[model samples]
Target: MSDFSRLRHCMVDAIARRGVKNARVLEAMRVVPRERFVSEAMAEFAYQDAPLPINEDQTISQPYIVAAMIEAAEVKATDIVLEVGAGSGYAAAVISRIAERVYSIERHETLARAAIKRLEDLEYGNAKIIIGDGTRGLSEHAPFDAIIVAAGAPVIPEALKEQLAIGGRLVIPVGDDQRQRLCKVIRRDATSYEMIELEAVMFVPLIGEHGWAEDGSRAASNHKVGASKKQSLPAMIAEAAENLPDFEDPGFGALFDRFADRRVILLGEASHGTAEFYRARAAITRHLVTRHGFTIIAVEADWPDAAAIDRFIRHRPSDQQQEPPFQRFPSWMWRNVEIRALTEWLHKHNSRIEEMEGRAGFYGLDIYNMSGSIGAVLDYLDRVDPEAARIARERYGCLTPWQKNPATYGRAALSRGYAECEKAVIEQCQMLLRQKLNYAGKDSDAFLDAVQNARLIASAERYYRIMYYGGSESWNLRDTHMFETLQHLLEAKGSHAKAIVWAHNSHIGDARFTDMGAARDELNIGQYCRQSFGDDAALIGFGTHSGTVAAADDWDGDMQVMRVNPSRSDSYERLFHDCGKVRFLLDLSPGKREPLRRLLSRPRLERFIGVIYRPQTELQSHYIQAILADQFDAYVWFDETQAVTPLGPEHHRGMPETYPFGE
Candidate 1:
């Protein structure tokens, strides 16, 4: 037999040897073309007991491992299964032959499309591929009888475990890349599970909203397919962001400046560790509102938490209520006067005011306690219908964040909206339980198994929707409301609307601005502004101090920005000799000028600007290191800096003036 044929035989032989006695699973494995899923170069070794690299840095799972996991699941023809990390959809296609239906999720768009094509070409009609965060799982078709994870994780993702049907099995590789254990977990009942170790295995790290941190690393380079020379940084960044549309980028700042006169700027500082950044956030907010006539203060507080203050605002509280519970001071009442404190002198004022520049006047959006956010929305629904609150909590466990919350459900009711969804799910659960009563005489244990499985599938279906789309609606609703509120305000005053959103740097950077290989397709605010407001919006990202100022105490008022260059000769040679390597020349600020010049003059200045020319992919790791105060630079990021760090140094790439900033 040919090597490929022999390996395929080996997989089937090993599976049978390992006690994978299912005839259907073995038949499915024999017919499926594993060679088509890997790269053209690796076709000769397709059936080997090792993962093969494919396009977009993904891998087709090893043949024996795939066969073994499939066999372990004990799938039947009537079973519905879920496959996470559906690379090229080869394994899913295999599962489709032995199961009623298969739902798979892939985070990378490239892999998702490729997998879809492979399945379609193979005529796997019962399999579906979704391009979204796999950590969230597929909700539209929930309660799968089995789920298999192809990637390794640092921890057992709770969301995935919740989606399994009662009596369903979940097989996943859990641990870091170097060391991992394949774990098969069975849901014994609600609030209980049985886990068994299968074997040790190695796999690529999972990256997405719920998996490991997609920390914008060198890891993305592993996906290299065909490359002549390294692409330009700008082209790489734009392509990565455009390819991945989840995170927002603020690269479209120039487009937004047109609406500068109209945008309402909101600011916040929530985390106690990064509270100082709020001072900068507030200072910018105050500068805009005071100088530009922008009005509106929104605090990130629960309305129910703030309603007592609202009663105080209207002077409706009883006389014996000496002070509002949320208030830090009794004298600081009214709006614009205290608003300046939050916007201008945030660091010196109360953390709440320093963090939140809005004083709840003309408009506001609250996101403090997520449960409170649900409650606030529920209060609105309750005013519309008294029973809405009770149904929401009992049926959907709709009060808190979806990842850890509880639920109630059925199959068809799974497609409805929140209120209707609750009624449908509860009714379905009852119907399934009723069916169990008819079969109780056969085996009491089996009858209870059906009841438990029915509820399991129902609950997973309900919880899946909440995780996939419900939590997302909270922010989407806020933005939609903001848009409507702005429209109303503009209509009333005969004015235009402008908005400045204060969110993480992830929300603002234009992915188009970064190298595609750096962050591997993250969406940011800049992308949304372009899509949402089009040419009318500007997105400016604040990123410099975020990675550098490690802790509250590391910074002093007298700190200056420092510029340095990496001493690696390869980078120097690339800058001076190579035509392909791009250089990112930056002009230093007044704060950075002196420190940079002094460091450049010293031969052993590693004590200050220890590392320079940091690989753009390592930015997030640097960010975490900076955040933890583990002893790192003042700032390390991919784009936007006070001092210049070149991809490769070329003096001509630097700005015209030697000393651009006046001392």
Candidate 2:
């Protein structure tokens, strides 16, 4: 056989050895051209079962791991499979042949772009590549038939569980850094799931948003392939807490100072659409920027808006100049809370924006119409055909077509005459509108007129500065626009200058941690920035406090909130509940407070019954009167020792339950 055939046979054998038996998966693997997905130098090893290094420190998953995961998932030909790691797009391409649709994510720009090309070249039309975090999963495309994690994680993430379709199976390596076992968890029903251990395997640690941290990754590597869960949560927490770096402590203020007397770039989370969040983020960004010589501010708005910002900087009229505009800004209904808040904030800040320009001409980091450039097209379409415009508006307005919905409005537009040449009038109107919206807002005649009157430097700047933000999709364009904006800042604004990126967490969090079987597998701005700046770039995830409710008004305030009662992880049948308070033990040392533990290993009582304590009622002063009436486990508290111990599963039916067990 030829070299290619030999490699294919070797790959198949490796996959079989891994216990992957699905015929469809094997055939898909057999037929797909892996060599095309890799570089020429490594084409010889394309069919190897090992991961090959790719650009940006990313690697394609080993072929056996990929096949085992796909087979374990039982991906049906009709099922829409969500592939979390689209490193080389080889796995996605193979799955594309077996699954109805493949939504793959990659955080590295080089990998994402490469995957897009490889998949496209092979005519994998069923596949769509998105550049976003996958750890959160594609909530918009909730109910995926299968989800395959390309990397190993310390635990099965909560977000992925929520995103799984009913009865869907998720194949992932779930364990500590020391030892990880392939765990296949099936969502048995809405409220429950069944877990089955598959086999032992190893792979690169998943690094994205919810993946193991560097410490956790290190811990995993220290253990053997299969280690038992031997440590308790409190012990582990204490160990991790004690071993953390000094920078994690309050004394690390000096490091912040060392970074610079330069400027404070306070970033806010804009992932959720609540206007309160954006306002909070903007206010924080402004306060920090203003306090620290941050004359030039930036946002994810369009280039035209950026230009308008420049005009504001130069004290020029904005109404007549159409180039710098808020074309991508959504003006539709108020259903999309995030978009609504963003638009309102954009409008309300016009005066503040003017002030910012006066301070130091704030630039729209996203100078091109990126994510919603199509929204600009639709806005222009409205002027030409009002009826068709209404349909398009309804198409996107009612549903967040930008999400991972099966029937996206953009896809529909492509199917209809909307994307064809037959709609010449509409198409021309859109083209002209986009041109005006994205550029300096001049017509053919006006542009020439301005050119004839402008200085050489001005004309050259306009020509050099003019940029486009469109690519694979609206979302993808938005990211590319930010990257370009960063480029412009590094080149145009000057190097060593600081700039803040205002985008979703998906764009900010490390891709290795965040992007996975997600709706869109696009490169995050953080990933790009890190590649460019190395340790100079840092990603701080804005995570919500679990078991607490944060109100909208609390954005600007600080409050110590209560946490859910703590519970042990081992026993599931305990009647113990979270008391939602921090108990202080009298005998404990200043630095060593014992974590409260449950008295029993399992639930001994059939059920817990309670009664209202009233002044007039019998046994009102007896805290355990009911428990004394019915024999039950007695809890004795020693005030001096600051300790509580369980008495017993005893019966004292007719008496007030007394603290029989004493110090």
Candidate 3:
């Protein structure tokens, strides 16, 4: 295949994985020659999953957006479609490949003429262009089977709604210029219609009688609530955000000194597999551990898995395992080179400390290892008391059948009513708590570890039993467990204990300020920590505009090194990108950047790349509406970043293959 053809086919495949399952839409997008629609200078980026600037100060909507809109419109092969804002004529061409007749309208006469010339040259005879106000739509074409608008509107236009044929779909972005929602309006009858918000989007304002006035809509919609009129968002960020030196620089460590006094410091990552996030967080943690006496490094990982690493780092004895920790799918999230280096450094730091409780410690706050946690609890009880071990086994055995695939238990429990073991696990945890004094007298650390394992079992049991039905409440359970685990560790370590939490932005940022809380009613660890600890907790979030990330397409899928799409125009990451700084830190505390914080308090998009990333459907799948200033106290930005270096089994811990247990 030719280079363009190969790229086009790859783009189609990527979009398929991104959740666009419409065969007609995929084929239409695949057949269209997007490279010919834009200027020669922009040809290379034609197939990229991003909008490229075109003539008349307009943009060609990204390939995925066009396909998604077309799919949303449900354009049939015999359908007559209308496209508004035919910038570069790309969307019209794609629609023409599927629809029988296509009428595209543009306000700019030059763009309309250019689109017509390209359509004729490409022999797309079914597609035609006309000069008109797109927001008002093509009235002469009236009653189109489908209508697609490529610009943002303050509200759905009456004319466009009226032009939709019965049972036809009109897909458009409706909101202010800075942000909008891709809405699907289906005309059920002459006077009745159904509206569905598909996803968040950002588009140039549709300029016409039915759209915005001659001037732009941003200033009028946004007023001077934050920064003065003279300073734009990017300029304000550039002035407010602190430009930090490289990770190696001592000054870089000094930049985090302001957080030294905080009891709990949560460091977030833009993605699970970004090397820069890992390296930067590790550097900050190292500085805090060595200079500021921070004792704990808690993370979003399975409890049993993290326990192994914690033992290794703190010079404590651990049960010898057949394989290393984090061997499960997406193992690279914790079993990568950057994390390895951090563990080694923490181990060395702990070795220097004579006070056992004061030494740096590593721990996990997640609850995903029911099997391992069960084994740990049983082994501990067996060593301490045979009778308790037997009782524990009997109680935990109620859940043994579903331990490997706990999701089945949730469904089975619901279908088979009395199958859940909630009472048994709860009793087990209470039993451990009641015997805490008796166990502590023997070996406090071991007793605490065993009790925590039991607590995790109880939480995991509930997590699996309710996960299938709990929806957002289950997510709440997980985060609540993590927050409680952090509290447990702090309580166990004594009053002077300090902690540094390492997790993704979704877990570390205050969820109340994001769609997670506002739309779904989910609370995360950061929100809980802030409410419980107040000013003692510092929630820091992270972001990256573009580059690459090591992620999987689905849960338990093999990892792939995928290119990160450029941040959406409405995201804080994009605003940071426009600041022209490769990396910086924005401190939005009480006095640092009052104007910047106020500007950021307004809702905007924020990307959350977990172990999975879908670039094609990114806006729908990953980006969440967030008030950045309220979500986090400090924001770290990297304009571009590279994927983490995942370690092979032989290279575990950068040690020799002979050392299966690792360096």
Scored by lDDT, the top model is 3
Provide the global lDDT of candidate 2 against the true structure.
0.47
For model 3, how does the per-residue alpha-carbon lDDT over 394-426 read when each residue is reduced to its tens digit?
Answer: 999899998887778878887787567888988
Reference-based lDDT, residue 360, model 3: 88
**lDDT at residue 619 of model 1 (Cα atoms):** 21
**By descending lDDT, how would the candidates be arranged?**
3, 2, 1
Write one digit per residue (lDDT tens) for candidate 2, span 95-142.
898999989877667788989998888889999887776666787877
Q: How do the predictions measure up, each by TM-score?
A: 0.34, 0.36, 0.69
- List, residue by residue over 571-643, the lDDT tens digit for candidate 1: 2111211222221212221243333322221111011121222233222112210110101111111221232
Candidates 1 and 2 compared: the better one by lDDT is: 2
RMSD vs true structure, all candidates: 23.0, 23.7, 9.7
C-alpha lDDT of all candidate models, in order = 0.46, 0.47, 0.84
Candidate 2 segments exceeding 4 Å error: 1-23, 26-270, 274-280, 305-316, 320-413, 416-477, 517-521, 546-663
Angstrom error of the Cα, residue 330, model 3: value is: 2.1
Q: How many backbone clashes does candidate 2 have?
A: 34
Clashes of 3: 0
